[model samples]
Target: MYVARDCYEQGVKDYNSSTNPWLSSPLNFTVSSTQNKFVVVGCDTYAYLSGYQQNESYTTGCASRCESTRFMVNGSCTGVGCCEVDIPKGLKNVTLESRSFQNHTIVENFNPCGYAFISKQDTFNFSIDSLRTLRDQQMMPMVLDWAIGNETCNDVENKSNYICGGNSSCQNSEDGSGYRCKCKDGYDGNPYLSHGCQDIDECQDPSNCNCPGQECINEPGKFTCFCIKGYHLDQSAGVCVPNQSSLQVKLLVGLGTSFGTLFLITISLVLFNAIKKRSETKLKKLFFKKNGGLLLQQQISSNENNVQNITLFNSKELEKATDYFSENRIVGKGGQEADRSLSIYFLHSMEENHLLDILDDRVKKEGDKEEVIIVANLAKRCLHLNGRKRPTMREVAIELQGIRKTSDGQQNYEELQFSRSEEIEHSDVSFTSTGSFSIIASTSSSTVLPLLPFKTI
Candidate 1:
């Protein structure tokens, strides 16, 4: 830090008027605004101080005026005789000018010379007697701002010239240039030297732990408190104790534990039900897709005009109809019987037409025998082992339609026999057949079998 000081004394012949100029070493020094002020003391004294900051020149001053010493107030410089003003920040140089407004003719007998100086604020108190006897004083104390350089905290932290020591942190200067050092939290002392900052033992302070008889453990930067076994803090008393016979405490603890156990059980049950419901839903979806539900929906959609409604059987209904999809409920072999009653009805209708046995009593003599024979033959062809030999559903529909137009039912039966050369004797079609009847399809490599046969009366 650098300070510039000068004084104006009485009887200095060559120095009647004084102008003190303070110049800094470029950016190294500045007049501290926090610690210094511009001051003037004596009757009819005019003082002006000028400085340059950030390339802009500025000036300020104070004037002291009084006719007699009786008008001056001791320890007060409110412009009656002595006056002062604060200095601006970042002032690199300053010039002080002192002048007399009245030529000192009125007060020179009592006050010979006026004094002006820049010094620490509030350091000087005006004395009414000093107006005539202050010529012997040489200099006044002032403060200046100083730092190592213009580098910031971050710029110095990684460099060899960093000044902050261990347990310390760097702080950028308030002027936005240079930096300073200070001890870190939980530590104190000089931060510019090695191992200067030391830890503070917070356990020494009894106020840190509210629990009387609790052990206070001091850590690196903090402290903790713990009670002995079976003892707890009584918050109202701010101390540790064991209340072994309090009914209210026992009741509170019991209620808390009961509520906690009930809460855990409730949560467990809720989670278990959620997981079970999700698993069941997922399994149902998988079964729906596997049982060709999508294909059935597509087919029903395509023929929506002919099929006015599509009914979907849920898992439970299907399970009941197919006897849980067990082999015991299926006729003719291992494939599922989706609707056991519907399958039985289909086979019974075929038997009523004399497809499996003698013709039904109602259709025995009056019904068209040739048409019945034609349908029975077609039904038998559907049970063919080779899929290529079976007629497609479209072809079967066309054949049934042609039977309606035929004058002779035998003609349609012979046409079906000519269309497919597969044999269908009496033994080939029977109600007592046990295994599944494989279909014959010309276009499909995979053969699906019919799983039902019926009883005839």
Candidate 2:
């Protein structure tokens, strides 16, 4: 029999025919005696085979038997002091029993039983109280079973009803009787159950794996990488970044082009409007100066100095009075039409030959109309000749009012005559070598002389 060194320190006793019981000694020894020996101490005991024995011997010890208070069940040494052991190689069977010292009465208060058996080391720890009754034990009995095959996982998988799923491989158990399943690479989880192995997405976690500048697409048990837009990945850095300054320059150029187009449009529009407004103002000024505005002002100033009642009409007022210079309001007789048309021409010529000639002709043709003749002749003489010689139109107008106050039965003739006196004057003279005259007149001094030689009617 073999025992642990620690078990021998607990006072196991040894006995043999040649050993001396009188000498006190430690009970640790590999018994090599020629005869079988028994080791008994308190309630614990053991039997060892003699030297060189191929099989061990077993026998009963003293008759101090202890009551059986434990039993083994289901290969577990769990009930009381009784236990099971792994039998050694080539071993058949062994018998076990209980023993007690003092007939189990001296130490019955603590330990009422003892047991003996052989077991694998560390399988059982004996109670100290059991040593009190160790002497009564005879032999312990145990059984062992053995098996004979060393099959691998492949051999077991060849059998029907194998549990390994698809995408899985089997591995032999270390004991060599059974097998276990594992999923293929890129998969995880239990392979024995249906749909147990799952595909691993490498793109989900940023660490351990990387797509970097590319798109990481997970497929069945694998992944794919593709570069992003606007940047090519540098294999060294394994990431995508912006393109070079050339791209930035191109963007700036496009932006500047767009702004330049808009700015040109704005400037063109401003210039167009400015030019159009300037042209309009220039045309208006041209019309104002060309339409005798300066001449009109000069005439008005001269008339004012002479105390004449001359009113200067604005162009709009004159346009309204003449109905926009309509043809119907134009006054003349045949060739004299244009001379009487415009007021500026009429003013300059009214004090010349035209008014006097008209007055003389009227006086001569109407003798019974003496008062009318007198008023017309006076008005004619007042406004006659050049600027220095002519009387102010104010003076002429005052004399006419005096005649109107003094006239009686001649009022009708005077009224008709007064209206004609203020009519616009026009000359029909044509300059010639002989001084051609459309309307000729004789001066006061010349009226006393005879008619001229080449004079016509």
lDDT of 2 by residue, 224-271 (tens): 676666567677876665567647977999999999999999999999
Sliding window of 10 residues with minimal summed lDDT for model 2: 17-26
List, in order, the clash count of every candidate structure.
Answer: 7, 16
- The TM-scores of all predictions, comma-separated, are 0.43, 0.24
Scored by lDDT, model 1 comes in at 0.68
Report per-prediction Cα RMSD to one decimal. Answer: 26.3, 27.5
Model 1 residue runs over 4 Å out of place are 1-27, 200-457
lDDT of each: 0.68, 0.46
Please provide, for model 1 over 1-457, each residue's C-alpha lDDT reduced to its tens digit, 9 standing for 90 to 100: 2112222334332253343545443575677878997888878677777877656887988888889888778998898878888878777677776677766666767776777777787777789876754565557788887655888987888999998889989887664367778898878889889888888788898787766557888887567787766678887976888656554687889999999999999999999999999999999789879979777777797985355466878779999999898876544333545555444555665656535344577876666765566666676566554668878776687776666555343444456554443433534654222211221132122322232233232
Which candidate ranks first by lDDT, i.e. highest?
Answer: 1
Global Cα lDDT for candidate 2? 0.46
- Alpha-carbon runs more than 4 Å astray in model 2: 1-150, 156-159, 174-177, 208-211, 233-457
